[model samples]
Target: MRIGILLHALFYALVLWKGSQASPYWMGLLLGSGAGFYWYGYNLLSLRETDTKLRGEFGSWTGMLSSLATMAAPLLSGFLIASVREIGYPLVFSLSLAFFAWAFLISQRLVTNEESELPAPIFCRRHPNWNRVLLGNFFQGIREGVFVFFASIMVVMATGSEWALGKFTAVNALFSTVSFFAVGKLLRWYWYNESMLIGSFVSTGAIALFLFGQNYRTIMLYGIITAIFTPFFLVPFAARVFHVIDEAHERYEREYVVEREIVLNGGRVLSIIAFISTYRFLPREWIATYLLLVGSMQILAVLILRNVGFRLKKSF
Candidate 1:
């Protein structure tokens, strides 16, 4: 985790010093591994601690806190970059260092955890349901990757400034923070499938709105609505994904976590590769096709959830 943050800070600092003229691309390649390490370190540690700390309900506040960071960080970075390049990147990166340091210090306060021997084989070699979840996670990852790839370009084309991208992101996440916690609460009151179904419907609607968002104003409005709706699906989907691990199989907890991370990361990596491959040659007109793919996959994810809920008679 420390190396991850340090590398990220280094990457941004390099970008700031040399601009794109430097091989920021190579720097980015280095940072990618750092990112993987970051994800593995923080998520792995949190997974170990969640049962002890959050009672496996980390998804609730995790979503809200993520939303808060999403809203605040970009806005701050945007303002810094736009009005104060002298202070922008360093300030933003420094804040990141502070956050990482704080998390490290807090973690130091916890008792050191010990590894234990497994009572049974780590994975559910017999169960098909968890495998199905992995398949769904992959498709969901594609949707997310494509959205991010396009949304940044779309915002730039619409409004010509990276600062505007940050502003757009901040606005998009404003209500997302509310919806994150709300969905968490909603999950407490309803079955996972029920909330997931509602979220899927909303995601479909939001994408349809984006299809018509040709102007920056329309795009910003689309961001708002998308924010309002996204967490309905995402928060529940994340919680239910981890919920597949039988709480009774505490010994297998780490294995389940690492396995799920591998599967989901596979999907994310594939989507990024696919996007890069086409992004180099594809014209902007192809965006419509991408959006269609996302909408179709959203429905497919919902279907998988329904299956898990009804057929498995489990987590959902």
Candidate 2:
């Protein structure tokens, strides 16, 4: 985790120093590799730190905190960019570097007493449930790959202002934070299947509203609906994944994490390629169609989870 944050800080430092001359491909590589390392370590720690009984609550708090950060960072960056045009981007990058540095320092205090074990080879055959969990993660990633970027871009296009996009994102984050809080209080182990089912249907169904119109109002409404329900899907799904990990041998936990990342990224890459491929053959006005198609992929994830049964032999 420290190494990952250090790499992130390095990326921002380079951006601040080089400005436009900084190679985007290199920057992307740095950021991508940093995220890969960060998430791998983060997931491992999450599994190690929390047990099955508290996993859902842990996930909710994680989501809530992340949403809070999401809500604040964009608004602050937008305000700076609008007010301090001369050095706005540099300031943002510098602040990001500072934050990453702080995170790295904080990570140093995280001590693990467990002995290190070598990870099993990537994608090694595992329990049937473990493979199903991987498939579910892949389908979830497919939806995320397109929606993460496309929805925000559509909002910017509709409103024709970065400030509006930031406000839109903040609003969504506010809703998400509230939803996460509610999930934390209300979620139970037995409710996993029901929560995911409801979340998947409502969030995906919200995309159909975009088909009616791709304007700011529709986009905002879609964002709000999805935001409120997404935690319902995400918190349980994450907890369930951890539960599956718990069922496996301790030595293979790191290996499972690597396999999950690989399949998730593969799904994301496949989704993006599909989007680009369709763009060449489809009309430009079919933006909503593309979103709907990708967003619906979450339904597949929910189905896979349901088919495998979200319950374990020893219930939390």
Q: Pick by TM-score: which candidate is best?
A: 2
lDDT against true structure, model 1: 0.68
Q: Kindly list the per-residue Cα lDDT of model 1 for residues 235-292, writing each as its tens digit.
A: 6576556555553345566666666667666766777777676667798666665676
Least well predicted 10-residue stretch by lDDT in candidate 2: 307-316
Model 1 misses residue 136 by how many Å?
1.3
Can you write out model 2's per-residue Cα lDDT over 132-177, one digit (the tens) per residue? 9999999999998888887788887787776788898899999999
lDDT of 2: 0.88
| TM-score (all chains, Cα) for each model | 0.82, 0.95
Which ranges in model 2 have alpha carbons more than 4 Å from their true place? Answer: 309-315
TM-score of 2: 0.95
Any residue pairs clashing in model 1, and if so which? none
lDDT of each: 0.68, 0.88
What's model 1's lDDT at 73? Answer: 87
